[model samples]
Target: MSNTGFRVYLNINRPDPSLVQRFGGIAVASIADSMNRASCISGKIKPLNGAPLLGVAITVKTRPGDSLVMQKAMNLAQPGDVIVVDAQGATDNANAGELMVTWMQYRKLAGLIVDGAVRDVAAIRNMTFPVYAAGITPRGPYKDGPGEVNVPVSCGGVTVKPGDIIVGDQDGVVIINPDDAEDILGKIKDVLVRETKLRAEMPWNGSWVDEVLKEKGCEYID
Candidate 1:
């Protein structure tokens, strides 16, 4: 109820597309450990379409069930940027529908993520453009004022700011702060290296568990 009128928006720097692009091929589960098992959104949010999402986040904070500010976000988003909407996880009303998604496609956006609900599942599923949401409903959104664009917002369970790298695949979505990209990218390489070696050994490790048990001096009695 506070600040119901237009709030001045902040200018957020745009992140390097290549940095976000680097994550498209990396699995979210693999990077989970590198992120300290944190900085991931709620699992409830997932893609309406199976396609993966990767781009800089153009963050928006909106009132629950409203698409007015979301429209503003879509208008402001650059090509190859993802519109990340914080709708406070509303389920009673949808935050977007087919029309907005179509507009997103026309704008050439990388993807869309709503921390609430959306409609038009069938239409969205028919296409390759990715749309992630917490739920789907027949309900539509309310167009009202009083939302912040290009600002820090919480989508699902993660705090995302403008210019942060956002990547999502079939498994789930994750955010990487622009400031932490270099460190995280290095960790990602390390994780991939370790996983590659472990995967190569998994098929040949039928006795590995029993071998470890023997190493631990465990005895079974029946």
Candidate 2:
């Protein structure tokens, strides 16, 4: 028998609102290296709105092509929570659309990141609501589903649990597990500074590689 009901967790520990905002303030690429480069959601998840987004994750794991639990997720979300949906990476049909987006906006949720497709792009963009999705289609999602909310779910190949921080921008989206967000956030600014300094020191002419080649005594066409 197929499981068609929904499961939800009402209580999840999320980061402090101020802390999430601070993490969001930094560029997604800024903390890329610090996270060991493994936490980024796929590049396919592009920003639907032309701005950055940051919030705690309200994870939803639903059957492919279904969004029943996603609807329930909205009820559980707090202001500034990012709805992170795991739809098994389905690409043919949208997992959510305009109505859901509108409701979420009214609730003052931070943003959305779906590891699947989404419809009603025009309305979503018009609202300036940040949304990242795997793809777009006119096809909508089915509500009848077997799913779970506020649980650990895989979004764009990354395991995201409720309360984890979600940061997305034009570059891409990444999941900062609640366990590591604070520690990583503490050093991200310093990492950014060092990165900026290192970048500033690099030569645009591409001669930096010559030192290593010379060290190895490699003879090659310059």
Candidate 3:
């Protein structure tokens, strides 16, 4: 790798389209539950809209206020790739805005997820593109160098690597290591089934709560 700010790796191992398809319909919350609730992205990063996010991760690690590396990553991204940026959770400067996001959408990218601030909220809200960020600022970003692409990076308290599956929705985003995709998919299916069962019983009283309270040695007070 060069010492330059534009450190990028090409030919990342993207997950199979079929596998990615399996995750697209699953809710981000259900995926997190299947992962034992350990890989949920921090609440600070939220979706810009209700559009669903499901694609292979193109991990980017950049300076808090720089987008040069991010721009490079965007160029390297494929039609269905999700550019996941780790900007150290900086909200003082906007790392991306309307122009940048518009280009991504034009390229048919899956989505953009930034662990830093982004700008142009008004225009972004008007589009169907899925964008998630920790904060928003009009300060804009510097195009200076010093970032890496397609490497392991942390975003919103979770570690993400190139080729990881990124799933997001109204709830939030979750990263799935491709190595565990099959197993996680199986668990997610089970979680969905259980949720369906529980939903069907909503009209009935929740007697299970009483069992739990008694097991914890709770005494009746009245």
Candidate 4:
């Protein structure tokens, strides 16, 4: 039973609302650190507006220069779903624009992330709805698509499946598997606490740097 292409997965077991809420408060950097800094989407996909993003993933795998499946994904996604489109990192064609963004806003989607390009930057930049993409171009995407919805896809160098938690901030985006989210959340708490203590240290501490240098047998110039 291999449905290789043009697939659609309707059901996704999203994380609990409380867990999503809890993740919403934490910074994406902290979440990345909790995961050993390996689950982050590539830094090339940047936020159009400086807004925090947190939501369940609604994965879309579209042809390099097409938006048909992405449009279908928009219709299928529910509120608080972040539509993460794997557009194969195509920047020559913009996958979405202001009109689509407005529709997403009207639908109350949490955010949108495209591993490609998007047009209508001027208009999208003014909207509060979170939008992140790898590039911008005036060229628009083709509507006819051989694509899939709600399936596992690669976006910005990260494998994302439907229902994965996506957290984004000014820094960038990171994907979290709902099954491991609780454990990651625990580690994030520890990271936050450790960061707070480090921040509270009035004078910067370089003793650890010296210790490491000494252990490595580095000769000091002075």
TM-scores of all candidate predictions against the true structure: 0.88, 0.89, 0.94, 0.95
For candidate 1, give the lDDT of residue 35.
Answer: 93
User: Candidate 4 residues 76-111, lDDT tens each?
Assistant: 989999999999998999999999999999999999
Candidate 4 stretches greater than 4 Å from native:
1-3, 219-222
Model 3 worst lDDT window (10 residues) = 1-10
Tally clashing residue pairs in candidate 4: 0
Q: What is residue 115's positional error in candidate 4, in angstroms?
A: 0.4
The Cα local distance difference test for each model comes to 0.85, 0.84, 0.92, 0.92
**Candidate 3 similarity to native, TM-score:** 0.94
Candidate 1: where are CA atoms >4 Å away?
Answer: 1-5, 8-10, 203-222
Best by TM-score: 4
Sort all candidates by lDDT, best to worst.
4, 3, 1, 2
Question: Over the stretch 99-132, how does candidate 1's per-residue lDDT look in tens digits?
Answer: 8999998999999999999998999998888999
Best-to-worst TM-score order? 4, 3, 2, 1
Could you tell me the lDDT of residue 215 within candidate 1?
Answer: 96
For model 2, residues 34-93, the per-residue Cα lDDT tens digits are 787879988877888876788888989888778888988888898989999888888798
Instruction: Give the winner by lDDT: 2 or 3.
Output: 3
> Where is the poorest 10-residue window by lDDT in model 4?
2-11
